[model samples]
Target: MSQDQSDKGTSLSLEQILAQAEQDQSVETDYQSGFVAVIGRPNVGKSTIMNEMLGQKLSITSHKPQTTRHRIHGIHTTAEHQIVYVDTPGMHLGGKKSINDYMNRTANSAFADVDVILFVVEAGRWTKEDNAVAKKLQNTEQPILLIVNKVDKFANKEELFPFIEEIAKEVEFTALVPISAYKKINLPAVEQEILKFLPKQNAIFPEDYVTDRSTRFLAAEIIREKLMRTLGDEVPYGATVEIEQFMFDEDEGRWIIHALILVERPGQKQIVIGKGGQVIKKIGTQARKDLNNLLDARVHLELWVKVKENWSDDARALASLGYNDNYSS
Candidate 1:
């Protein structure tokens, strides 16, 4: 999806919604705020949904499954509510490796702590993975908003009625809506449902903040997203982008970010670097443009590809790659 996908939803600001709410002075509306977990199986457009909601790309996304490794928080604050959206790794049916266990742990941990969960799934496609997530939801009484994403991909609009009816029988959902996260369809409806469930309380984060992640983290994620889109399925498993150094120049008024792209082996590194370093160069250029827009300042991005043998399987290696347990907490 384009970086401007968020713009599609921002035609009406949250404040405008709050202004309408404030009109009724007799109602005495207490401020609402809470955490919401966006959970689903891999490649279900969870990140795409949240990024569009915030009108900024805080999370990295690609066609590849398991693209989101950390439980990232995108904060949307207003006089009415502050919704801290948690984008977790897609829960999968695997545990042979430490990374798989780490992803499952990161995703499942959010359910217990959040006020609402967006159980996302693709339109007209229900796999065993979706069934696994629904089966787990049966144990919890938390308010779940069943999000059937990618409705635009369907050949006919009528295809959604049966899809909605079939999936509704699988679980008890608080609300159900079919949306195209990529096309910015029905996002406001989802946002309204989310606000309806949030508890009445003061805001947890500052009003200006859109995400809990730093600019450096966003840089690395942008680079990884470009690599995923560029390399396609040829990209190796367990590849990650880590920012080595992030600093701003006081004299030049620009941000300089040094990133290390970690791959499983030398052969995979060769694929990422490409002949004459063309692939990595392309990734850096694309990432730099997003950084410029995200920070609203000049950016100089330095990228390096390195081999880390089986880093995903080793706990210490995962920590070194910035997958530490504290990152999400």
Candidate 2:
């Protein structure tokens, strides 16, 4: 017997060892999959990058900060690999309340058990706040990919290189990619670099699955996103969307969704409803369009704005708004 067979004793052969190794490798190759977390300060276009990467809007985008409060997973699959992207809340320095603390914790938690960390930075200007964030990311052991977003707005790319180089000096990154998520430039290059770090593994999600959030969850988020965009800063930090009812009729080919827009004060409620209820109507119309597209069915969306003072501080109100105190693991 050969030396390999001798090591395996009389029960095994060299061919079997080689075959098992090949099988393992095959499994690994098929399983080219891993989780990647996108982190940055608010309004850095993290959501834009994720949507562009997946070619869908799994996470809502807005100009306002703290749009994303939870960790949302967007899955992308190909014949060779599966990439699960985790979209997190924008990290900020400090806030007085527990909710702000929760948001910060949720963003930081995405770094754990992730294969790649994409640190998104605004390209137009680099602030001291951005530098502090870069330092925190540099402390992580996982591969970091520095993505400078909004590059299209830059008048001179040469002026931006110094900021990029400064960040590079702060941390060891696998790659530094400068691209505009809004303009969709150099996105393919970013995807390719992310793929290189994922391990081979079977698909963790169904092929058709795009997001881990439920339809109700998405509906609430879409409503809130429209409110954010339309109402702008008039909406307070404590405002949230609560789904009162979500029902579908297969025979009728229609979905009936009833959601309430919870605000911190009565004045804010009036702001959401607008003059002659026109503002709420617009928000409903826009949300319904998104819901129909997401659900692929006719949607009847009913929205109501109500005053729920201090919802952010009220534990019961927070839970009703899907901000479970136990969300932190």
Per-candidate total of colliding backbone pairs: 0, 5
lDDT of 1 by residue, 155-227 (tens): 7888688877877788889998789999999999999999899887666565765765555566778888888
Clashing pairs in 2: 31-200, 31-201, 31-202, 32-200, 32-201
Per-model TM-score on C-alpha atoms: 0.87, 0.88
lDDT of 1: 0.81
The CA lDDT at 162 in model 1 is: 82
How does model 2 score by TM-score? 0.88
Off by over 4 Å in 1: 1-29, 155-158
Q: Per-residue lDDT of 1-329 in model 2, one digit per residue for the tens? A: 11122111113332453355345555534458778999988879999899999998879888888888878878887888778899988888766666677777788888888899999999867766576677788679899998989898878889887877777787778898999999999999898999888877666555655666666777788888998888867584668888898777667768889999888888888888899999999999999999887777788899998887887777666665777533211
Regions of model 2 farther than 4 Å from truth? 1-30, 325-329
